[model samples]
Target: MTPPVPAADAPADRRRELRADCSACAGLCCVLPAFAASADFAIDKPAGRACVHLTPDAHCGIHADLRQRGFPGCTVFDCFGAGQRLVQVAAVERPVADPGVAAAFPVLRQLHELLWYLTEAAGLPLPAPLRAEVADLTGRTEALAAGGPAALAAVDAAAVRAGAGELLGRVSAAARPGGRDRRDADLVGAVLRGADLRRHGLRGAYLIGADLRGADLRGADLLGADLRGADLRGADLTGALFLTRPQVAAARGDGATRLPAALERPAHWGAAAPVRTRRPRRPGGRGGAAGR
Candidate 1:
């Protein structure tokens, strides 16, 4: 049976910074990224090519009606400045060039992903040691942002990741709930093997590394929640609402697991039941491609 998606459980105070402040950016994400066919993306797009729906000024052409037009994936992507940083400093000469112009685009993508995680870290509670680490990394990342493309390309990604990882480990440890606190709390890594957490308010909670091997999370609210590293080996998330596909991709589930209707099981978790498939034919056939 198809399970219902959980309602959002994220708190109002826990709002993510959309960084719309980045509007001044040259629309690097719109011009330099690639996407394949998936639940989130309805069509394929080549790198550096402006999404067919992207406007001359780099705004989404369908900005006023994305969901109505079946382009929800655009809503979930977060660039974290990788696109802008690359374009401004790395390829300053290119004017809205193709996605392939920046050799460091891939590297920038990784850094931006890291930045996403670190940005979330800025909000979590942390110990003094971890907090200190977060401050240092945040400062360094900010400095790197101010540094031009050459400096960004010269960044040691591994070292930055290590520092972020250390701080994240601490944040996860500190954020974990204990004993009955686990009864209705967000357990990022609580070692619960068979807990029942159904119909609870888990909005915006962290479930990373939680041992939900046999837990029951059916009918739970999971809006805007982060479930990375969560183990859903034999757990039930059936009928959980508002659990987006990208959120599902971030978790680890197994064959015995149950998922919400709108999401597909992560490949690492096992082959999920196929929901839909189409012939290799493009959406519009060979004549011409559809707009983004």
Candidate 2:
């Protein structure tokens, strides 16, 4: 059995810098995606239109109280540094209305996400050949993302993503042999507390609202898993593969939740944290309710 790959220090730093730099960004996320009034959003926002809460200098007006104000989606949405990248590429004071900027934003966003995964995959304990392949792909994706808006628009992001996904699958299978295959399973709201899920294949699994508290998920391949609202308190995710920020941000993890070193714990998980080995009941009291 291949030993679990600890998150590599070099790549982990790269991944941290890969996340959204809101201060340098011009609130592209606030204007790029449409927000239909729903559970996550409180208003109907048209595509390409600046959100009502967006300040003139491109900051969210109600950032501190987004969830309480009925915009929980805003809390979990991460652009993976695409917003600032766009601003740098365009060099324009306002990028919200530029058709080229608008078109390039999404494609660059997807590429940057792939870059994140590829960066992590490159760090895994794979054979030399696979490692080389990961490096090659990373270099190519970086080159592609470095292009100006016109070059970015010319990119076929879907095709690139498809190839990357396939390669990543190979990397995961090779790195974590004998993992259970549960790709694309619909496990919404399933109670799976304290389960031994080591090396499981959970790619694209619908784990929405699933009770996974204290689950042993070490080495599980979680590529594209829909982790929205999943309870992850006390869970051991030290080496969970392909785990992305958006998935973790959408989930309900606590300070006790062990994540890959590359990931930042969602602030809503708590303002502070301490490692706890023991499993506790769905916590409450002074803390808000947990487990959906």
Q: What are the candidates' C-alpha RMSDs? A: 16.6, 6.4
Q: Give all TM-scores, in the order shown.
A: 0.50, 0.89
Can you give the lDDT of residue 171 in candidate 2?
Answer: 90
Model 1 residue 69 CA deviation (Å) reads 2.0
Q: After superposition, how far is residue 18 of candidate 2 from its true place, in Å?
A: 1.1
Candidate 2: list runs displaced more than 4 Å. 1-8, 271-273, 276-292
Candidate 1 residue lDDT tens string, 49-143: 77787766666777666645776566545554455556566554333654343445555555656555555555544555565676577677666
**TM-score of the candidate numbered 2?**
0.89
State each candidate's clash count.
14, 0
Report how far off residue 41 is in candidate 1 (Å): 3.0
List lDDT for all candidates, in order.
Answer: 0.59, 0.87
Give the per-residue lDDT of model 2 (tens digit) for 106-137: 99999999988898787777777777788899
Model 2 scores worst on lDDT over the 10 consecutive residues at 283-292
